[model samples]
Target chain A: MRISVQLKDFDIGKELKLFNNGDTNIGAVVSFHGIVRNNSEKSLMHMDIEQYPGMTQKAISNYVEMAVERWSLYDALVIHRHGKLLLGDRIMMVATAARHRRDAFQSAEFLMDYLKSRAPFWKKEVTKDGYQWVKSVLDDESALERWR
Target chain B: MIKVLYFAWVRERIGVPYEIVETQSGTVMELVEELKQKEPRYEIAFSDLSAIKVAINQELCEFDTKLNGAIEIAFFPPMTGG
Candidate 1:
């Protein structure tokens, strides 16, 4: 398992290749990407992501452990970018590998859902009016609860 | 002593993210009331319980739950992650 929370750009192609490793045993790999979107109603100038260092890593690692135990995944990769991010920025990526598609798919989705609701990261949007902090959506919480 | 954590708006409003408080065994609500008495900043930060959510160690929990041995208590707005 590899987890990275940093302020650097990532190449998906390179990441996928590294994950595959030409290992025949790895039959399935699932990946998900989260990008910054430009909305009409709220033109987001940028986003500032804040996190608590030790706690953030602990929280993410714990989530991954649960996913592996629950889904029988072989390996997983999670990368989340921090600092000032503009429109079209890659916010995060989750990849899971397993011997079967079901394990790969379910683990990938579960990892995303867990990260979406429980990750200890705060996003502040720089809007036209001013910097506004985003609120937690009810649906996000409900999505995580569904898995439990 | 339990370590309390505030995040995002709650942290900004409270002007800090962590505090170590000495308290006897009490419910989360009792801690909230005690926090409100600690300072005006906490009072304003926790004024709307409906907007805030508590977590015991990282799992979502209710404010009325007992905090007998909780090492960490986290307060934040509804999770808007993803």
Candidate 2:
């Protein structure tokens, strides 16, 4: 398992190659990539992602541990970027490997859902109007209830 | 002294990222009340407790949680990561 919080852009193809590692028992590998959307009222100029440095890694690792246990996953990888990003840039990615497709897919979705609400990162959107902190959506909070 | 940290707009409203607070409060709620009385900025930033979340020693915790020799506490809005 791997969890990376960084400012530099990541290569998805390279990350996938490193995750596989010729493990024959891994039958399915599922990945999800979050991207910055250009949905601001005045068009998004950029986004500043702020994070609690010490807590971010620990929080994510806890979720990854849960995913591995609940889904019986073979391996998992999470890479989330901090600092500045423009619209359409890759924000983060999650990859899950399992013996079957079901576990891999479900674990990846679970990771995304938890990451959205539980992680310490906050986003400030900069648009033509000005800067504004993005508020947490009610839908995101409700999404966690299903897992409980 | 407890190291209190703020993030996102909480930091902006408080005008600082973190501060060292010395207080006699026994719980996080009492500590918050003490802070709210310090300045209007704190009052405004923490006006809605429902919108805020607390962490003690980098772990998510409840407002009623005890201080208990904790070295760090953080207050911030709900996370919007990923």
Candidate 3:
């Protein structure tokens, strides 16, 4: 029900509290948080994320709509950050609410899978050696085929 | 005139984020060929079309797709988001 593409960091606790408020019929809330990993070959300085402003939001919204319809979710929230991020920083989060745990869990994973490869955001890893654009992994693409 | 935009390394190679182009190409592939003839930078960036992805008016499409009055076209590599 909510999609946010922002530059500022988000408070996980606060976001969950807001999402869970006044929802009496919701039995399960599942959430996934993505963080910047520091374990690359070279020591990472930071990550530079670039996105196509208008297109990114539209792509994410379409994915969210698909998740809601497929899982019959009661509510869903997606918060993705753009710009620079340091190691250990939260990059994005997806939360799904449903009457049962199955729908909540599956929908969150589905959203994450689609967002990883389908969204317009591109990441450049700035390491001790230099900068390089992160390549799209075959595993990520294969993961999405299961939902089809 | 169509607005052509590039992202990530494509932008870095093209040396500009976007440009206005006037062309008579009828398909995406034709437009790319026209661009490749413009300069060496474009040729180098578009050398390996297999690694490139194209979008017509913000919607993903194949290279053979017709350019039917599309106002914008974008070129970038596969996305690595989230």
Candidate number with greatest lDDT: 2
Question: Lowest lDDT 10-mer window, candidate 1 chain B?
Answer: B73-82
DockQ comparisons of all candidates to the true complex: 0.51, 0.96, 0.89
Q: How close is candidate 3 to the true structure, as a TM-score?
A: 0.97
lDDT of 1 by residue, A25-111 (tens): 788999999988875675789988876556667778998999888887778899988788899999999999889999999889888
Q: Is candidate 1 or candidate 3 better by lDDT?
A: 3
Give candidate 3 regions above 4 Å deviation.
none
Worst 10 residues of 1 chain A by lDDT: A50-59
Docking class of 1: medium
lDDT for each candidate structure? 0.84, 0.95, 0.94
List pairs with backbone clashes in candidate 1. A136-B79, A136-B80
Q: What would the DockQ be for model 1?
A: 0.51
TM-score for the B chain of model 2: 0.97
- For every candidate, C-alpha RMSD to the true structure in Å: 2.3, 0.9, 1.0
Off by over 4 Å in 1: B56-61, B69-71
Each candidate's interface RMSD: 2.1, 0.4, 0.6
For model 2 the local lDDT of residue A117 reads 91
